[model samples]
Structures are given as structure tokens and as C-alpha cells.
Target: MSTVLETRNLTKSFGEVKAAKSLNVGIGKGEVVGVIGSNGAGKTTFINMVTGYLAPTEGDILFDGQSVVGRLPRDITRLGMARSFQVAQLFPKFTVLDNVIAALVAAEGTKASFFGPFTTAARRKKAEAVLEEFGVANYSRSLVSTVPQGARKLVDIAMALISNPSMLLLDEPTSGVSIEEKFPLMDTVMNAVKKHGVTVLFVEHDMEIVARYVSRILAFYSGEIISDGPPQEVLRDPKVQELVIGHHLDISILGDAT
Candidate 1:
């Protein structure tokens, strides 16, 4: 249960608006935690800060027992932390295999060889292997824009995981996926991450998805965490029910799911 990630009084503000306020939490090694909230509830803001996409206005972020306060996103990734966005981050015009190869280059921190021979046979084999691992090998030769949303998501996550990070943060992992595709998408992701023994923190609006995958939940409102604990406990809390879940989820059914 050693902590892999921690935030101490973390705060982020844009002008007079405070997007995240005095946040504090600890995620242990190999824990799969879910972050839930209404729109603009600071979930993404917290993710951005932790991943170094946005620097905190005050306080600190510690990853693997060291302060990462002023580090850049690439530096954080190199330190064994990686994240996938709410929107799949991929090159639309590139084939899935090529995109993965590009990600591999970035993960290796090698200078891009734009003028000549960027994709070596070794790189292609590795990229194909990663694509196969993520269950997106069928789309390897397809342009990313032509692939289904679920497959695109898998590729984006595959790119993030190419560096073999110890901790993986996913922002709205199932967003834009159809109802029929959600469970299968998450199943693939959870299985792959579990195989890698990576700690996971994901932001999601789908209650069913959250209830099914996460061992613990953090509910946010007005830029603050109102409840944090096991899914059963957090989902049943009066404050969390009113502010976060609202009419979207029926808590009684979720008792057995978590």
C-alpha cells in the first residue's frame, strides 16, 4: 500500500477562477481509483497538474516519493508517469502502426529523424507488438481517423503505456464511446494495465463504468473532494449522491457492483 502519487494542498487558478482548490490525496502502488464529478468539477484540472500539463498555483505534487512540482510533462513521463487524454491523442492521418512507432520514438527520448528512415525494422516490430498487446492490431494499417472511437482510444492508451510507466492516468477513458462499446473498451484497458501492474487513476462520468472497475472512488464538487473511499461508501455518501451522482445513477444497485 505504498503511495505512488500524492498531492499536498494542491491548488490551481486561472485569473480569479479557482479550478482546483487545496486538493490532497494519495494513490497507492497498483491501486485502481476513479475520479467522478460534474462538468468543470476540477477533475481534468487535477489530472493536468499532476501530469505537468498545468503547473499548480500553490502546493506540490509528489510522484514516487519525489517532488515533481516544476517538471514538464515529458519529464514526468520519463519518470514513469504517463497519461491519456479525454480525447484520443493520435495523428489522424497516420496509420495506427505508424502512430505507435512515433510514440515509441518519443518514449525512447530519441531525436526525431524526420528527414530519413524514421521507422526501423526494430521499431516496427516493437510497435506492432504494442498494438497487439492493446488488442488494436486489426487496425494497425488503418488511418487513425478511420478507426472506430473505441479502437482509437486503445491506440492512445497504448501510446501512453509504451514507456512502461508505473502509474497511468486516464481522463474520461470511455468518453465518446457508444453504450454497447463501453464495457468492452474498459475491459480491454483494465486487462492490459493489470498485466503491466500499473497503478491507475481515471476520470469518468459514466457511473456504471466507474462502479465496475475502480476499487476506490473520489467524488469532487466545486473544486474540492467531498468524499473519498471505497465505491460503496463514497457512492452512498449523502453529499456525493447529491452533488456528483445526482439522478444519473441508482446507488442501491451499485452496492454489490463495487
Candidate 2:
């Protein structure tokens, strides 16, 4: 597959601390890649820089071969890249449908006013379609704060997908979800993204989830990528096991899950 995203010598530093080191990585089109790291690792920093949430102290980022280093987050979104946070970013007070309508308005690059009617019938129908696309239509009229955690995650992902992005960066998609719900939640997300042929880069801590969903793994240690390869190979790497995974796991079992 052709390269969809590339970071060349990417570096981000906050004063004396290096959140991201001189990193170079490339993600191919339609690849499902998992990012794993400990607390101080640069996983989130990498996502932030790529998504334009943080300016890189050095180096460049390219989305589909175009430099997005200095682009605004919305501008990057307009370029067909979208991201969901570890904590679902949603309008807590808005009805789920209304939340999606707001996203649709922003995706269209139209200025949305507090007093204006942003939700036309066509927009509402589109929002409903998005809700159904992620299997969250059942919560269409419910407040975002009142839904289950899994539903909230789906709602956030649905909002991201409404923009029809070619590449989606998901920050810990299964965080705060119960174990029984994690697989189903990931299944829903993977299915939706695959339907759109979207490339995915997700930060995940769960070994099973990472092994099951991603074709490749990127393991970060202290702001640097220490391992990058197929899931089984990276998972079984002794250094990765000691520093990241923190214990030996039978890759055969994880492979079976995949």
C-alpha cells in the first residue's frame, strides 16, 4: 500500500523534557496500527503533533504526502484526517443527534451560531445516518453524559467518522470501557472504519485488543520508538516485554485471538 502518513525526524520538547524524540515513521494506506507505551511514553504526543494539537519543536509531518506541520486542527480535518480522544470529546449537554449535527456543520466549514438553526432536516437525516453507522442511533435523543461508556466512545467515533476522513487517529478507544464491552466496542469501530477504507492508528494499552485489531505495532519507550513491526514479532521482543508489555505473554494466545 502507498504511504498515507509520514513523520520525519519528529521531535517535541517541553523545556527539559522530551515528549517525543527524533522519530521517523510512516503509515501505509489502510493499515491498522497500534501504538503502545508506558505513561511517560510519547504516544499521545505523537498523535497530538500529527493532529496539529501541538506544534513540533522540530521536524515535519505529512498527511498523504502534503506537509501538515503548521496546519490548524480544523484545516487538517478538512484535509480528511480526524481524531478521537482517550476521553470521548462530546457535547455533554447536547442530545446525541444534536452533537452529530454540530459536527456536520463544522465539517462543512460553515460558521455555526448559537442562535442559528444549524440542524436542517437534511442535516438531521445525515446525523441519523452517522448515528446508525456506528450503531449509536438508539441513543439519538439521549444526552451524551447519560449514555454508557461504550456508547459514548462510539458517539465520539461516529462524530469523527461523519467527516468521512481517510485516516483516523484514535487515542485509547477502549479506555474506561468494561472488559466485556471492549471487544464489541472495538469490533464496531473496526467495522465502521473498514467500511470506509480508513487507515487507523490507535493508542492502546490492552495487549489482547492490540493484538486482535492491529496488523502492526509501534512500541514507544521514553519518547522513542523501540520496536516497530508485525504484532507478534514486536510483542515477543525481549526488550518490549521488559519495558512496555511488562511481562511475558504467550504470543500464540494473542495470535489465536487475532
Candidate 3:
């Protein structure tokens, strides 16, 4: 795996508060990396800078060996990267099918073309296939407002996938999803990413999910990476154990493995 993304001494500040403090990390292609941090640890800020949503106060971000410092988010996406939000963003009034179709339509460049003839019929069919792949085929005709939060998240991710991104940045994919539906949701995401060779970098608080899904974990504390390694190593670290993993995993979850 080659380095697909890298940050050099990345720093950010808002007014008098420091959000990120001289951080550095490298992410390889096809790797699923987890970022765990408490509130105000600058996790979102870090994502923003990487996605070109916010310019860093200092340091640099390189994607695919090129600087992405001053580009816009859309510009970044056009370069084969897409990001999903913590709270799934969807056009509530639109039917699930339309929301996805809209993304497919938008990808072809016109928003109000209503005629649906921007791309070849083959491409439109491809978008519909993606929706079916995520198990949203049944909700295709339903309104986003009518669907459950988990389904909305699924649809949102499906829309992002329709773009065929090489790297996916997910803020919190399982946020509103029910516990029972989680594994299936994760299965869909991981399967799609792996089959497509899409790299993933996400922020999540759930230790179990990180352990099961990501190959590496990056622990952020007060705007800095305190630990980075395999799940067992990072979670068992005294530093991470005291901070992020404290409440989530007790003696029971970690057990004699300690």
C-alpha cells in the first residue's frame, strides 16, 4: 500500500483556541483508518482541512502526492474523493430514488434537466444498481423524510458511492443506525470499499466497531495524535486506555486479554 494521503505538521486555530496542534500522519491506499477523539479534540477540524473544507493555519495536506491546501471540497471530490457527514444529509422531501438519482444526475452536470438524458442510459442504470446494492431498492420510491435514520444514512452513503470515489471520508457512518442493523450496514460499506479498492478514514467513538472494521486506529487527544497502531495495541495503551477507551470498554470487554 502506497501513501495516498499525508499531513505535515498540520495546525489549525480558531480565534484564541487551538484546534489541531502540529499533527502529522500518513494513510495508505486501501487502508481503513479510524480516528477517535473526545469533544473538541479537533477531529472534525482535521477532516475539514483534509477535505479542503478549511485551510490550515500552518502545515500542509497532500493527496495522491499533490498539495490540496487551497482547493474547494467539490474540487477535491472531482479528484476522486468524497465525504459523508456525521448526521446524514439528505433532501428530506425527495424520494429516496430521486435523492440518489439526483446525485447521479448532478454528476452528469445539470440539476434541473428533468429529462434525465445527460448521460447514457447505461450510466443511469449503473446508479440504480448502486441503490439496489445498498438494500435501498425497496425504499426507492419512499421519501427520505419517511425513512428511518439508518436507512437515510444508507441512502446517503449510496449516493456518495455512486460517484465512484477512490477514497471515502466518513464522519460517523453508524451514528443513527440501530444496533441490530449495524453489522449489516458495516458489511455493505466494507464490502463495497474492498471490492472497489476504496480507502477509508473515519471518526468513530465505538471501540468495537473500530476494532472490527479498521486496520489501524489513530487516537486524537487535545488536537494531537496520542496513539496510532493496530486495534489491540492502540486500545491497550495506557494513554488511550485512560482517555477514549475508558467508558466504552471495561474489565469485561477487555477482560483477561489485558
Could you give candidate 2's per-residue lDDT for residues 34-98 as a string of tens digits?
99999989998999999999999999999999999989999999899999989988889999999
Summarize candidate 3's per-residue lDDT along 12-128 as a digit string, tens digits.
Answer: 989988899998999999989999988887888999999999999999998999999999887788777788898887888888887887777655455556564544577558867
* Residue 197 displacement in candidate 2 (angstroms): 0.5
Worst 10 residues of 1 by lDDT: 249-258
- Candidate 3, after superposition: displacement of residue 118 in Å? 6.3
For model 3, the superposed segments whose C-alpha errors exceed 4 Å read: 108-120, 250-258
Each prediction's RMSD over C-alphas, in Å, is 1.2, 1.2, 2.6
lDDT (CA) per prediction: 0.92, 0.92, 0.83
Q: How close is candidate 3 to the true structure, as a TM-score?
A: 0.92
Query: Candidates ranked by TM-score, best first?
Result: 2, 1, 3
